[model samples]
Target: MKILISWLGKTDIDHMQVDKLAAIATLATKHTAPFDTVLILANAWEEHWHDYEKWLNKRLAVISRPAEVEVRQQSLSSPIDYVAIAAVMLRNLQALCQGDNQVYINLTSGTPAMTAMSVLIGQGMYQCHFLQAAPDNSVVEVRIPLDFAATYKKAVSTSVRNKVIAGPSLSSEFSRIAAESDAMKAALNKAAKLAATDLPALILGETGTGKELLATAIHAAGNRSAKPLKTINCGALPENLVDSILFGHVKGAFTGANNDHAGLFEQADGGTLFLDEVGELTPAVQVKLLRALQQGEITRVGDSKTRQVDVRVIAATHRQLATMVAEGTFREDLFYRIAVGVIELPPLRHRTADIPDLVKQIMAEINAVFSKQPDYKSKKISSSAIKFIATQPWPGNIRALWNALNRAVLWADNTELTVTDIQNATVDAVKTDESSPVVPEFVAGFDIQQYIDGIKENIVKAALDKTGGNKSKAAKLLGLANHQTLANWMKNLGIAEQ
Candidate 1:
């Protein structure tokens, strides 16, 4: 069940007067001598790619005797596309590997970035054997040593027990949060699984979408719960401050270093470190972070001695990290390292079915606070009030909803919170002070098409509900060409016109 994977480089002679394919062809002989198939990792954009692929398959057919040979192409914009290279290699292994197969990867070809990525992924994840063909036509297995996990070695065959944190990821905190939509539910479930593993997890979402809450729940569900869970806001800290905050500094390390400070890395040693707004980290800090992950240790700001840490990193950000990497603002290597696991939280407006339940929860908590006050009563929302709250486009997600509830509950005259009170509070919430009157800079995951369609549905539904299913008035309120257009929209969107 063993297979061979190698990249097809130019057939031109190297500095050592050796052909690259000579090594690949030589390595394939040993790997395919007892194999089921072969996977040739090639750059399809390169000239004469088909010729190389055909030659390798023909050579393997005679030298090794494999049943099939397939060429996997790389279409990345450049040879330095580490992310794409790793993805392709891992995917090839996933598809070609078997339970008892010995996977051999020829590292002599491909870009240096590709070689590094393939080695990292092969060693860290796939446990594949690395092979290199010598100039003398001799092939030898290439072994990689890992820093984080001492026992991790290329092509190791011994079975070892996994030591992940033992618990269900869905703790009471996450369970209590109402995410009724299927997308949110799926995200939470996957986040929980990722929380248990040592792989770094990235949570992407709009502001107030509860990214930190999810990270906290993940920490609570992991093996390191007993240890301190340290948090740092990457966006808030300046470059120098970030160094001291994350990697600590010895006493008098800087002008203001009055005392020895333990950075977030040392504080969170043997625990989880939540890096909030990770996308805002400067290039220097990103480089340091990457080094720490690669070396499985960190040095203080003033000390050259590296301290070993067994910390799991969980990062959250609202910025588009892929775009940042493309723009050269974020390190591509660091992005791939931290992006091992990703979770995207859906905004509250997309899952409005949970609004009614959230209303109840918020009101109950609000009443508990009011019970201690004199001349004040707890508040309750009517069905109509909940419906209105669900219709409004919540750009700020759950945080916005909570704030609006505070205003509505306080403005209510009696125990029963009515529609007018909610409307009044909504109006008050929309007003801005003189100092900051302009709109927010962040879009917060707002989809223009989705928002427009949702607004249309709300208007159409509200108008029809108000006019008692009067098509003419509903169309007039919606400014549609005619009632026919309204009917068409409802039909296309699968909305019942009744």
Candidate 2:
């Protein structure tokens, strides 16, 4: 049940029948090595493989024992046909080759390109042994060194092929949003394939899984790319404002209403509307959304008129809508309406193989952002730094990875980001969490400067409230130089005077 996949070299070459030498070496091996069969890959030059098979069988018969034999004719199209060959080998070997049977590839024959491909498939994916029909009448076994980077070469190769075939710009966007993991590739390709249809798509992924990004890509890849794509975060809005924000509100529609506002649907009239975290919508909002999906119309708050709109919808959620449906929290009809197409994104931990690419990607963008500031300095990451990062269990997925790298970019000074730099960045996050008034989960991903500015704005507002809205008293309570300084701080933070 042993097998050796060897190429049938051209008869015009000096190595007219490479399989014969390979067979002799296999028979002469130290242990009774289980090299009992051969699978030959041949091209058009092998017009009389039957005669060669007869010759090969005669040569093999002279050995201690006979082996099963077969030859598959193939059409050569490119110099690097190994990609397709490796793909086929991956599919078939897993299905057919297993158990006590041993496998090897005879790389001593064929074109240099073919031999190199054999080595790649053997070492990269199959972990198969290498057999060389040594001219000295001995067998040469090639063993590849083992390492974390070396072990993941097969996965890396697949990712490279996917990126190459996916085109430069399209693959760039997809990888930026959801690196080249097998799961993400499947989900992403499915989204793109189905993007043209008008059916509603439901994207499922955990927090920081790039649901919003994927939704946007699907919209652009579809027929609606030419039109506006309005997006809203359902989770951030309160139950009362969901209706008004999504379906429009007239002037004086409520107590504080001052002017008419077009909702997402109206704004996206002939395009697509993306609802991020759709599972977080209140039951009332869900009912209204269901009505809109089923009836192709939306009614403004406090207005009885229902206006017809032709807006395609793409809903995404990190939560389990099925569980909510079972719990009677989400409408079953709404769930079905939005579930016309479903794509589940894998978490970052599952796609650790894609981390290196993500590191390069996020770092490039981080550098671009850094170049915008006079005080901020751009940073590059070391290969070891990337390796150290890939070893971590990124529970927060891509967002957490980016957040850590963002800090590292700011922390590193005139040096490439190292393992210690990344560790320091994460350590700082831990310290920030311990001293925060709120829970770490709530503040984990907030930008440091933005968070500080928000705290300053809140404190200023609180001081003014306690001082009867008097700028002078607020400044006095805060020990500022004058009311003008307090006013300037407020203006800088974009907080209007009360």
Candidate 3:
């Protein structure tokens, strides 16, 4: 059975009321193949669906088509509620996409969120053909490239399944992570699947992007849940004690080695070992780390014999290891080993839709801490305050957002925090921290050009997202000379235009 599925939009309703050709109408009349059933999803008032179905039936009859019309209400908390939209898409697809049923998804007749969800779910999870109707009354099949389609299918299918099983995404270890954007959800979906195996996983993201939190979650959800999950910050490890700390040492092995100490690899035996900022490891340490990962064994600093240890390594770094490999800093062999199950976490700015939920969670934690104070006074943030906070570029990611919220709550002298409070908080957050303005630490092997290009990529992408991919508007936002300048920069930076 061939079926066409679409969401009822305001423009679609208006066109039907005026007896003009709507997006769905155009699809039905112009598409080469005829649909056996036309399923219309409506999420508006009750009366809207009734009138829409009536007009839809009349139009189909006028066209002399015998397609059956079915209208169903797809409830949502709001037009842009990504969680609700994903769940609805999953349920509908699970029901309609049975064996031998050909499904056609109309990406032309709905809100941007609706259309996006349809594309992601339809193209990624199911064998559904997609159609988009332009204002010219022409309908075209939306084709996704093969490689991306396969990845999209895997990531999106996992996301939908996790959301469905968790029932509102609140119970499971993966569900507890608050997220509303597709980027974060996709990352989480990949993480959950990686958790099921003992493969070495690499998580890449900016600092304060919750790499450690994700590593811990993967450990807790994996088969090694009963064993110890040891964590070590390679960046903070003492240069002299790096070998002793990682592979352990026997008594009298070194000047300070008075006792036989077990290192992290030994301690994390039969479980997972999280290597935070793995890119910071020195060249010598990388060889030993790679040995342990490949041989499943390690030798003490002064010991000639190697002892077996079962450990799954989950390494994370803000640095681009591939760049390091090209520069001959990080080992290429180790890179491929840990990158078997790589997951790149999107920075907080890219997943701004999650800010509100993160705010709520942070506020609850703050309120709980404040309740213990003698002169505690809990505060609520106004919607405008949230909107204002969401507009800024949080270069520091979640950690930055948390600090800003904390500052706002502490400095604001009111029960309810307003936009002014948020604005003041942001200004104060950027003020000079000591003698001069604060500066980020430049570590060894830091690529200044790569860093600059990263900032440009982020800013350009944010502008494009804000302007709905309009080159002219995005150029204006970035203070560029013109859209042509923006285009040149985008091409140079490899920032693809959607």
| Clash counts for the predictions, in order | 0, 0, 1
lDDT of 3 at 461: 78
Clashing pairs in 1: none
**What is the descending lDDT order?**
3, 1, 2
Go through the candidates in order and give the C-alpha RMSD of each one to the true structure.
Answer: 18.2, 22.5, 27.5
In candidate 2, residue 296 scores what lDDT?
A: 75
User: After TM-score superposition, what is the CA distance of residue 40 in candidate 1 from its true location, in Å?
Assistant: 46
Residues 1-498, candidate 2, lDDT per residue (tens digit)?
A: 677777766531223345434433343232247457767767655566776666556666676556666677754565466644554455445643578766777776566777776666666656577777655656777675654355588788897799689884453445446456788778877786668588899999988877888888888877788999998888887787878888898888998888888888889987999998998888777877888888877888888766667788899898999999999998999999989899998988788778888888898898898789986666789998887787665657788889999888887785599877886675423222223466424565768777787667767866665454789978987789999999999899887778
TM-score of 2: 0.51
TM-score of each: 0.55, 0.51, 0.54
Which candidate wins on TM-score?
1
What's the lDDT for all of these models? 0.75, 0.73, 0.84
- Candidate 3 local lDDT, 1-498, one digit each (tens): 889999877888788778888888888777888788889888885676777777777877877876888789776868887756877787798899998999999998878998888888887789889998988989998886655576768998997898679774222777768779999999998898888789899999998899998999999988899999999999898878888888999988989888988899999988989999999999988887888888777889888756667789999999999999999999999999899999999998799898888888888887787789888799888887787677766778888888878888888889898876766666534422123213545899977787677667766876675565899988986799899999999999998877
The reply for model 3, stretches above 4 Å from the true place, is: 1-171, 428-498
**Candidate that beats the other on TM-score, 1 or 2, i.e. the better one:** 1
Determine the backbone clash count of candidate 1: 0
Select the stronger candidate by lDDT from 2 and 3.
3
lDDT of 1 by residue, 383-402 (tens): 98899888776667778878
| Stretches of candidate 2 exceeding 4 Å from the true structure | 1-178, 375-377, 428-498
lDDT of 1: 0.75
- Indicate the residue-level lDDT of 331 in model 2: 92
